[model samples]
Target: MPKIIDNLHEKIFECSLKLFGEYGYNEVNMKRIAKELDIAVGTLYNYYPNKQDLFFTVLKKSWQQTFFKLDKVKETNYSSRKKLKYSIKILYDEIENRKGLGKELTKANVIKKESLDGIKDRLDGIIRNLVEELKKEEKIDIDKEIEERLIRVFFLSVIDMLDKYAKEKENNIKFINYIIDCNFK
Candidate 1:
């Protein structure tokens, strides 16, 4: 019985992720998610009392998956520039793939402002780790504060450009490579 309950919970989470990723939090409701999972609304509520709870649960899981991938990239035997590129590519791909849901969440203010800050802080920590790895590789020599600032600027600029001109994939890579070279070289 516990195993069956676990399976039902997993099904709900999977269905919620799909619906939330495709339709955004504002447009998706518990009823829709339950229907998509072929579960009763009461069962869905038993798992997640409210939409916000379910949304945050899914968001937390997605962030964990992203961090796991980034951690794997960090473990790779690649050059600092290559590592940074791969990390950025991972982020860029995620953003591009979920552009619609991202825009919807932003436009609808579905996520709280403080939650956004938390997400930014987590992303910055990943960048900081990358920068630290680069430092260990003797690829960059700068004060910690300056390095962090530069990373923040570069990351934000790249995201902005990608959001604005997502179709220019090659150009984006070139632009990112240029920045990496100019900074680390």
Candidate 2:
């Protein structure tokens, strides 16, 4: 089992995310993070070797939280296609709701090195499940690999579009539904 961090580490992450989200990553330095945490700069280093590690941890936490939310809403009255649509809509809604809760993806600099592979892997896990369920209902061309790419593309395309729409405060259920309608068909 993995080691659990103490409350202080959690505080560090929370404070860091809040400040980073509000001020932009470039302006939120270790001194600022330390000041917000009410701890010395050296203390945070015990939890994270450096700012990059902290940022990476925050990004991973965000992804995991997103996955958890998706899992909670996995059971719905929609078809597999609709389920996927709802899952993405849920993601967009969460991002919009939590826009200032953490660092903005577009502006995040500390965690820049994090590849899309982590997101891709998590997404593939979801899509694989969807494909399995979808297979039970209809004949899908799983062997050619084209089907897999299409699912990934469809998901990414819709999420990216909805993410773009999220820039405006008004919850764009129509925009979310639009992507859902176009992609999850």
Q: What is the overall TM-score of model 1 with all chains considered together?
A: 0.77
Per-residue lDDT over 1-185 for candidate 1, one digit per residue giving the tens place of the 0 to 100 score: 32245588778777877788777787899989978877678888988889988887777676677778888998899987689888888876765665554443344368666765665677788887777777778656777676767788656656676678778977886787677677765
Per-residue CA lDDT of candidate 2, range 40-99, in tens? 787778778877677667767767888887786567666776676677666656555444
Q: Which pairs of residues collide in model 2?
A: none
Candidate 2 deviates by what RMSD? 5.7
Tell me the spans in candidate 1 whose CA falls farther than 4 Å from its real position.
Answer: 1-6, 99-108, 112-118, 139-146, 157-162
Overall lDDT per candidate, in order of appearance: 0.73, 0.63
Cα displacement (angstroms), candidate 1, residue 101, comes to 4.7
What clash pairs does model 1 have? none
